[model samples]
Structures are given as C-alpha cells and as structure tokens.
Target: MAVLTASFFALLLAAAPAKAPNLAGTWRGGGFEIVLKADGSGTIKDSEYSPAEPLKWKASANALTITEEDEPVAYSFKQDGDRLHLSGGDLDEPVDLVRGAASAKASSKVDPQAAPGSAAKHVGPGSCDGACRHYLKCAGQPALQAQCVLACYSEGYGADFMGWFQSLDCVAAITVIAMLEAQSRGLQGGGGGGASQSKECEGCRWDGSSCAWYSQGNWGSNVAYSGAVITCNSSCCGR
Candidate 1:
C-alpha cells in the first residue's frame, strides 16, 4: 500500500504544469508602462497625468501579484510570442502589452555625442522651437531639457489631447515632434520601426452604445459596454 501511495503522488507531480516565464523586461500598454525586474522589484509609469510609482511583484505559475499602495493585487497572465496578455482585478478584459527593450541606462557617465541609438542625446537649447523653448528655459540646463522631454515622451505622451497637455506638457510634445523630425531625416531612434513597434489604433471611438474598434485603420468591430469603462477586444487590439 505504501508503494501504491508513492506511485500516485509521483503521477500527480508529473501532471502539474510548469512555472510561468520570467517577466524581466519593459512592457507597454495603451495607458501603462511596467518595468519588471529580475529581483521582483520594479517601477510603473502611468500616463503623463499620473505620477510614477515603485512596487514589488511576485509571480506564481499562472498569476502575478503586485504590492502597490500597501495592498496586493493579483493578475493572471499568459505569454504569446512577444506579447504578454494580463487579465483580472478591475480589468474586464485582458490587456495586451508588447515587450520593449530595457529602459534607458543612467546618464551620469553617458557621452553626450555618442550616437542616435543612445537613449539620451544632448541637444542645445537653441535647437528647440518656441513651444519647446518655454519648457527648456524652466529646465535650467540643456541636458536637463533633453531629459525632461524624453521623460515625458517615455510616459506615452505624444499627440495633443483635449485637456491632456495645455502648456505644461509641451516638453512631451516637443520630444515626440523631434523624434518624428529625426525619423524624417532617416535617423529614427531605436532603429527603424518594425512589427514589434506599437501603433495607435486609428478611428477608435464610441458610437452611441458600444465602443467601436477598428482594424486596418477603419471601423471593424464594436464591443458591448454598460459601465464607464470600455475594454478593447483582443481580436482587434491584440496585434
């Protein structure tokens, strides 16, 4: 009987699933950017309107727990190729995040004229336009000006929203414009845009009842909605 019991336990162990993959990289969604580290510690940067927060994380076989705001929130995640799909807790539907390269390294010893591939590039204040000049003046130094612009842009601020950026967030706008300018000159940052690059869904808007999601830059499908929140369907957004 003891031999039979041991055999049964071994079978159960063999049937168990393997642990989840290590999430030790940068992930970007529509409104959030998470940098999960190997040490279970990381930082989250919300939209330009919200301040960044540091948090600790723990991962199990199929779920991840984030300790933020003195509370633990659990999220079940699945990995599909280069995308990480997360769902649960406050999320009505799964949110897909594309894996990005590691965050920019510290700038203390970084060379100013290294290369365009370098995360931080020192630009003279005179190179900025009128809109960017206002923010650069307050930034004090040219290095700080560039850092400020990159910081805001990295937080996912680019196009001018209705009330998202009036004048205070001009730094973010300038950074995005500069990147576009560079791309036009065949000097795109982070190499040329590839399939991994995130593209904004064109023509995504609310009709009268449901949120309309577009595929191929035009209206394609509508997702039902009753609450104030509108969730994008994975079929449409999970590219």
Candidate 2:
C-alpha cells in the first residue's frame, strides 16, 4: 500500500498538453487492441487488462492522453499512415500498432469540439470506485487477496500506481507474501472463494481466461503467485 507522492502527480499534470491529434481508428499490436472514436470516447482491450476497459482520450500535436474512469495517463504518439507508435506511460519501450477495420459502430470522423471528450463526465477521483469493487471480489478468496488487490490498484490507478510502486522492492515482498498465503490456505482447484486455480506459464500473459505468450523480445508476464493470477510484466515490477 505505497502512496504516490505529490511530485509524481505533478509530473503527470505537467506532461499533459492543451490539444491532441485525431487518433480515430482501430489500432492493434502485441496482445492489445485500442479503438479511438471520433467523439473522444474509446475502449482499450489487452490480455492483461479487464475486458474492454472504458477510456477517454485526447492529444496534443505529439502526445496522447488516455483517461480511465477519471484519471488521465499521457504518452507520446506518432501516426504514420496506418501505423501508430506510442511511448511512455507504463510501457518499458515504445509500442507500434497498425490500423485495422473498426467495428460498425466505431466512428473515425474527428470533431474538434468532441476532442474534449469524457473528462467532464466524471466529477472527482472516480476511478477508485472500480478498483475498490475489484478488490472486494478478490477479498472473497483468502489466498488470492493480495495479488488481486495489487491488480485492482494497478488498473484503477493506471500509471500512477504501476509507474511508481511496481518499481519498488515492496512489490516483490507483496508477491512473496501472496504466494506463502496461498500455500497456507491450501489452494485447490475451484476453491470456496470461487477463485480460478489456473497457473500462468512463464513468459505468458493471462487474458483473464487464458495465458498468451509472445515470441517477440521485451515481453514478459507479471508474477502470478499460486492460483491468484495477476499478470503484467517484469518491467512493471522493476526487474
């Protein structure tokens, strides 16, 4: 339960720009899919994230902003024809994406006014609501509580949580404790907490239902101790 210092938040606020480029399209790369709409609303799907995570986005001339719930994370971006490149945020390295056919309901037209997007939709610090709810679900399973809580916080706080704490020694301590707790609880398949007992293979990313491993370099999965699987990357833990 490490707290993010005020300076960290200040850094994020400073990274934001007054405007953004139109990124209305479907972009896919690695194990993630991002759909940016014309109206400033968007959805990001990643094997490591909750399915179809709702988001708001905007960009300056060279930066992209992604707002989840109500918190905004910024990344430098460049659009070249059908390819989109992104750096910063939670990425250990830059990610490249290719534009694909969007869903029928997805719009690509850019409305300059709509670029303001969903920021006004939320009042204050609402992302915690989603994170807290997920933490509660994980709490039901005694063996997996810590791992689950970690995941909840990671998603809820986004870069704020991941960018800071995951790089600390406490993260490893948390993972080790979670593993020991699981053994002490005698984790079995389909336990009383309704927790899944599936183990993530090394170098694979768990997509909630399955583990996906990519051959490309610079890819790794988060520590999944015992049956409580919270998959991310070693970079996220500052390995």
Candidate 3:
C-alpha cells in the first residue's frame, strides 16, 4: 500500500508543469508596447493611438491572461533567446517583442547612414518612385492619394521612407500602391457586387443611391433598392 502511494505521488510530481518565466519588463513590438510588473499587472501603450490602459494579469506555464474592465484576454507565449513571441488575445497577427533595453543597445550598433527601419540605403530612381507615380494615377485625386501613400509608406517602412522605397521590388511597390489606393477610396473588394458601402447605412434602410448595397437576409424576404439582384452574406452586409 505504501509503495503504491509513493508511486502515485511520483506520477503527480512528474505531471506538474514547470514554472513560468518572470515577464516583468518592458516589451516592445507591433507599434505597441507592454510593461509588465512582478505583481501580475501591466499596461499596454499604443504608440499611434490612445493612452495606456491598466490591466490585471496572471501567468500560467505556457499562457498569460489579462483582465481589463471585467473582460479577460489571453495570449500564448514562447521565449527564444532575447525575443518573445506572443499569439492569440486581441492581436490579429502574432506579436514579437524584444526587451526594450536590449533593443536600444542593438540599435546603437547599426550604421548611421543606413535608414532606421529599412535594410537598403539607396534605391534607384525607378523602384518606389515609379510605384508611387502609378499609385497616384490609379488613386484619382492628387491630395487624397498623396496622403494615403504617405501614411502607408510610413507604416510599412518606418520614418526612412526613401530607404524603404529602395528595398521594394516592382511587384511589392505596386501591391502597396494598390492597397493605399483602395484605402483612400474606402473600397474593400470581395463578396457580392457593391460590397463596399457606407457604415451609416448598415441597419438603416438602403435608400436608392449609387453608394448603397443590399443587406444580407433571406432571399425575397426583403429588398433594399428596386431592381437590385445581389445577395451578400451577413459577414459583409447587415441583416
């Protein structure tokens, strides 16, 4: 009986997971930053938007749970050397974080003449410049197109716009230009015809207008505009 009890205890010990690493530090990536404390609390700072939010956090063997305003958000994490990879939670894409202090030290070692966020220092005249010109032509209005291109370029390549432009091949440049053009026009293609519509018309009755599209629902049950024949799913159109 004692031998059996000892064997059971040993199995339980073997099954227990290892302790999680201490995550008390500043982690920065994805244009946002997180500061964790030893007391299982943290704040998330969005560099492009709002101020930091205070949250309570709990760490498990392989995951971390954070609670904000009574809602809990969870993320699975793994650390490899100096880098930490986090997935799930509110993130649409996986976030890679580097220790803030270490990142600064590494940045100091880089060449001054090279652009901050881009690899290649100089690109020939035709690369990104050609792409930008093509984007302007496809984008219509000059003022709005310029704004969209600048925003997209800044986001994709960081502050060193010239260096980043140099790094892109013809295909990549064209793709970026197309994306910016679409963004400026507020047209997200896919789904049924006229998939792009104003958000204000979601629940409201679609008055007959060129910008209006049919809301998703049982066919023949309801119709928005007369003679409109497109059927969109609820994912894109409102019921």
Candidate 4:
C-alpha cells in the first residue's frame, strides 16, 4: 500500500507543471529567520540580532541567492529537503524549518569559537547545566536512559504533537580497579627475591610479555627486600 501510494504520487509529479521554485513558508536556521509569503516576496531576519533589514534573494538551484544589506554580498545556498545552507558576510549558519512544530530540544556539543564567548561558556548563560544523559550515573554503576514519549492530538488528529524521554536503570557494571591498585602497592614490600628487571613496557611492568598477570610496582620493596633486592641489569650472570 505504501509503495503504491508513493508510485501514485510519482505519477502525479510526472504530469504536474514545472515552474519557479515556490519557497512559500517559514525557514529558520541557527540564528536567522526567513518568511516566504504567497505574494512571491519574502523577508529575512538575522539571528544574531542585527538591525532589522530587508533581504533580496534570487532562487537559482534550490535556495535563495541571498543578498544582505550589510556590505559583503554574494551568498551561496544548497537545499536538502527542508534544510537550506546559506552563507554570506560573516553569516555561516544554515536555515531550518521550525514553524508550527512542537517544542523540541536537542543536545549538541557546541564549539567554543561558535558561542558568544568562551571561558564562562562551560557553565554560564546558554550553557546546559544539568547532568548530561550521555555520561549520567543512575546509581553506583551505569544507568540506562529510558524515555516515555507523549504525543498529543487535536480535533481528529489536529496540528499539534509531542514526544519525550524517560530514563530507567538497566544494568550495573563492575569497577574495582581502585581497590586493586591499593592492594598491589601493599604487596610490593614483601621480599620474594632478587627480582629480574621488568621488560613489560606496554602498560605497567609485567612478569613476561606473554603473561597476563602483570607484576606489581615496587613502591616500598627497597626497604623490605633490603639486600634481597638486587640491582637490576640485563643479561644476568646465568641469563
């Protein structure tokens, strides 16, 4: 049924007329607002709160050949469905469709250079202060992010819908490395014997390259082993 419907729509397009690119709607970007009216005219407002100025554009490919009244002309645009990448002057932001849509928020790792300023950008204005869902811990271990999306309908499926997320604890992971590290340091002082020079250089020193049980670091072995701890040298007496 879906395929047939798509085919029917394709057939209609084959019979429809090809005319000017009718950009009659509201298009929004990072910090800019554009409104295309039915009268074939439009107005663009910059998002950075520049002086309210009129904009002139020529539709060539699939975007408006925008000309801002702020010197530095010549803007390039490429269209992908409901998104437009437009740039001229210092404006390097894209225009998106966000009119008549439900309130939606997306988490993004913002670049420092792109924000109003740096330093205070981490926890200051416009900064997301709450714990991020990506690395948030529910309990001792890792927590599972559960979400319950709620959608609303109007008179016979009206023009308003919504969705949300609810998090839940799913699994717990084992993390005892701190305790193990402490225990390993305590065992280093016991006098086993004159130890061979450690050759495992990849990570911490190991007993041998092929062995997984890594040897411990001699934090206090010098005092405990005293004469037992021989000065290490490669190619010993017996090799």
The lDDT of model 2 is: 0.49
- Model 3's alpha-carbon lDDT is 0.51
Q: Each candidate: how many clashes?
A: 0, 4, 0, 7
Model 3 ranges off by over 4 Å: 1-9, 15-17, 106-239
lDDT of 1 at 208: 49
Estimated TM-score per prediction? 0.38, 0.41, 0.41, 0.30
In order, the Cα lDDT scores of the candidates are 0.48, 0.49, 0.51, 0.33
What digit string (tens of lDDT, one per residue) describes model 1 on residues 1-239? 99999999999999988866778887766345677889999877533333446789988877988887576889998877557788885443566666664223322222322211111112222222322333443333333556655654554533432122223232343443443443334323345344213222223355545544322211112322121122232323333
After superposition of all CA atoms, the RMSD between model 4 and the true structure is 24.6
Q: Point out where model 4 deviates above 4 Å.
A: 1-18, 48-51, 68-74, 87-239
> How would the candidate models be sorted by lDDT, starting from the highest?
3, 2, 1, 4
In candidate 2, position 64 carries an lDDT of 89
Q: Rank the candidates by TM-score, best first.
A: 2, 3, 1, 4
Task: Name the regions of candidate 2 deviating beyond 4 angstroms.
Answer: 1-20, 48-50, 101-147, 150-182, 187-239
Q: Each candidate's root-mean-square deviation in Å?
A: 19.4, 18.0, 20.1, 24.6
| Candidate 4 overall lDDT versus native | 0.33
